[model samples]
Target: MFEVLPHLAPDPILGLSAAYREDTNPNKIDLGVGVYKDEQGNTPILSSVAKAQKMLLETETSKTYITPQGNQGFIDGMLSLLLGKSSPVLLSDRVAAVQAPGGCGALRILSELLVRCNDNAKVWVSDPTWANHIPLIGSAGLKIEKYPYFDKATASIRFDAMMETLRQVEKGDVVLLHGCCHNPTGADLTNAQWDEVLEVAKEREFLPFIDVAYLGFGEGLDEDAYGLRLLIENLPEVIVAASCSKNFGLYRERVGLAAIITEDSKTRNIAQAQIQSIARGIYSMPPSYGGALVDIILADEALNNEWVSEVNDMRERMKTLRAMLVKNLHENGSPKDFSFVNDQKGMFSFLCITPEQVREVREKHSVYFVDSSRVNIAGINQQNVETLAKALVSVL
Candidate 1:
């Protein structure tokens, strides 16, 4: 059996990360991974998380397994964070939430839940969605399809095409949407565009499955959640997968939430039972540390304020970095205009360069980017922005 197994290629992003680590170039820049990095080229833990950990360390007493749904405080806090504190859904007690290992786990668990709901459940994702989505959802035995999303030519959302494709989605099918800070292409839908998508979703009668991994990275918390809230408000049913990896700097801790909004309280309770049963079959229970930390931070007044401030700082830094890169590219006399980078939100954007050009930049300039030319805006710093700009210009 072992001898019959075939070799597999490494994941593209991880492969790029390994290559970057091994490169001897002193000025090498890594823009491959999706994690947030500060000006010092480090993924710093938020001060609020540090404080929360200290508090937990000092006062916490138990190491036993948590409930199948994990910490209730964490579930409530995440619900408030995703929806508003006074959201009608929460007040009506129509939402069911469960903690998962991380965003990916939340997605997979939710996908499995969909399978339980409908044997032939099909999930439609963006054409250029995060690569892991394919395996994470598909491995659970759900059929996957793609709809047009980002257009490289204009460096913007292909809204019309996306809407047209989604129009064909049949009832009971699930559509996976990035809640905010769209991965890979950072281009987000405007409020008007979101309204259009909502109209289509309503007409199609398909369930909306939203993945919200980078909530605070796009804009303010509420601003970033606008589209998600819109769908939840209008639709009788919605599914949300949220992560604390980016906002809480809990990457290693692997904290995430899977929420289901149902048509009524009875349905919500049933969904909760089903989701808890699914969690029991998957990881048994989510790790307690990360969820506990998030609960502590959200429950405390000062720490909550501090965490929001820290998230704002990170968002502003990414915005500044986007502007800085575009400025550098213009000053370097690049034949192309990167002004669209400034208009986009969050940690990533496409350079819109070819795969060959991507390889050339990596081989010749020691600047690493994924094949699609998506770069993490957080990877650029004041020290290396000019160098990166020059390298990009040379490749062009």
Candidate 2:
């Protein structure tokens, strides 16, 4: 019976990691994965997290399972941190949150809830969103539609085309929006464009499903969440899948949360109950470590400040790398203008290289990037930037 089980396709990003591992080339550079690496080429644990772990070790605590809804304080702190207390949704008692395994877990559970609730509901995602978005949501038996987003010509967001596509959306449609630092394509909507999106959502009565994986990496904590905050102000029911992987560097710990915004406490409670049920059928409960670490950091004033500053440092460092790459690429006699890369945000940038060029970089230059040219800018550290730049020049 087990043998009858069909073969499975490998995850694109994960597969890349596996392939990179087996490669014989010693000089191969891997920019395929989304993990952050410092200038020394290390994904170090932040000092704030170290302190949190130390405090946890000293304190007497039970290893018993946390609640299905997760640590109450984590939920509260995460909600407040992601969406401030004074935000319209929270102020109206319209928000409900539950801890999930990770952003992927949150997305899966949310997809199950939405599709199970209404099979007719359509989820619209950007044409070139995170590749996993399709399989995760589709596994819930819901079909996804594509909205115009990336404009290769300008290497920027086609806001006009995006708005036009969304204008036709009706009430009850689930539009999966990246909160900040859009994956695959670093191009994102501006604050003014977010306002326009909210206006359209309001007019069309569409529900907003926000995925915020790279919150602090884009602009800053409060700044990255600006679009999400605006959505809550306009929409009554919004679904959010927030990830601690990028911001807190907790990818391996699998930390994330799913939230819903509704009109009243009664509805919020009902939605929360459903979320818990869904979580139980899935992972039963989230891992305690990452969530606990985040909770400890957020709850402590000094530690929170330290974590914020560290994140800011990481953001700035990525910005510096982007500027350097753009500058160096332009000066290297390459005809292609890579200046657009500087204007992009977050850790990942679409190098705009074709599949052929991508393959050439990997084979000849030993530079690894996704076929779509989505490369993690963080992977190019100080030691390897020039090497990567020269390799990129060779490929281009």
Candidate 3:
């Protein structure tokens, strides 16, 4: 029976990572996976996370299992991060939140819940979303629809088409929105576009399922969460699946949270209970270490400040790389205008390269971006931006 099991495709992003490991080239550049790397191309554990971990190791007294919803403090901290400190959305404690394994786990659990509640409910994701989103949501049994998002010709968001598509979505459908730094394609809705989207969502009566993975990696912590917060404030209820993998640099730790806005504490109590019930069977409870560290840092003023500063530093570095890369690519004399890269925010920029070019990049030059042409902006440093730009020009 085990031998007869069907073979499967590895996750495109994570799978490319294995191929990256096998490549042998001194100049090999890996801009495929969404992991963050500093100027030296090293993924470092943040000093704040390290410090919080040490404190947890010293003060945490039990091997006891955490609640099914994990640490409430962490959930609260995540809320404050997404919704500002003075947000009225938290009025009378009307939000329901749960700690999940990671962004993927939260998404999977939400898919299951969506199926459980409404089998016919459709989940509309942006065109060319995170590769895992398709399988992750589809496998849970629901209608998966693609909303018009990226415009290949312009190498940016087709907001007009997107808004038109979203306007037609039926009531009760789940509309997936990338809160910030949209995965795969970095093209996100502008502030005015967000207002238009919310208007459509309100009129159409569709739920906003926000995916916020690269918070600090985009504009800034608070800046990145602008859309989600605005939705929560203006809408009656909203859902969010947030990942600490990028901002907290806790990828292996797998810490994430799912939040649902509600009408009141009574409504929140009902929703919160359901979320825990769903989590009980999925993973029972989120891991203690990462969540606790997040809680500790958010609880402490000094540590939280340091973490914010470090996150800001990472954000600025990615922006600098984007500026430098776009400058070189424009100078590369390619027919394609690379100015779109500078406009894209967050860890990735969708290069819109074909599979053949992707192969040429991997074999001829050691530069590796995803087959869909999504490159991790964090992987670009001062030393390699020109090299990557030249490689891209050569292929073009």
Best by lDDT: 1
**Model 3: per-residue Cα lDDT over 1-396, one tens digit each:** 699899998877888788889988878899988899999999999999999999999999997999988899999998888888889987558888988898988888777777877999999999978988888789889889999999877797888889899989999999999999999889888888888998998999998999999887777888787889889999887888999999999999999988888867888888888888888877688888888989999999999999999999998888899889888988887668877888898889988878889889888998887888889999999888888889988998
Candidate 3 deviant stretches above 4 angstroms = none
lDDT of 1 by residue, 1-396 (tens): 799999999998889999999999999999999888988899988999999999999999989889999999999999999999989888988999999999988998899999898969899999799989999999888999999999998888999999999999999999999999888899999999999989999999999999999998898999999999999999999999999999999999999999999999999999999988988887789999999999999999999999999999999999999999999999999999999999888888988999999999999999998999899899999999999999999989
**Per the 3 Å backbone cut-off, how many clashing residue pairs does candidate 3 have?**
0
Query: Which 10 consecutive positions of candidate 1 have the poorest summed lDDT?
Result: 275-284
Score residue 268 of candidate 1 by CA lDDT: 92
lDDT of each: 0.93, 0.88, 0.88
Best of the two (1, 2) by lDDT: 1
**Candidate 2: 10-residue stretch with minimal lDDT:** 85-94
At residue 52, candidate 1 shows an lDDT of 96
Writing each residue's lDDT as its tens digit, candidate 2 over 28-135 gives 788989998888778999999999989988883789999998877778889988997666566777777888889999999899889767988999999889999999
In model 2, what are the clashing residue pairs, if there are any? none
Give lDDT for model 2: 0.88
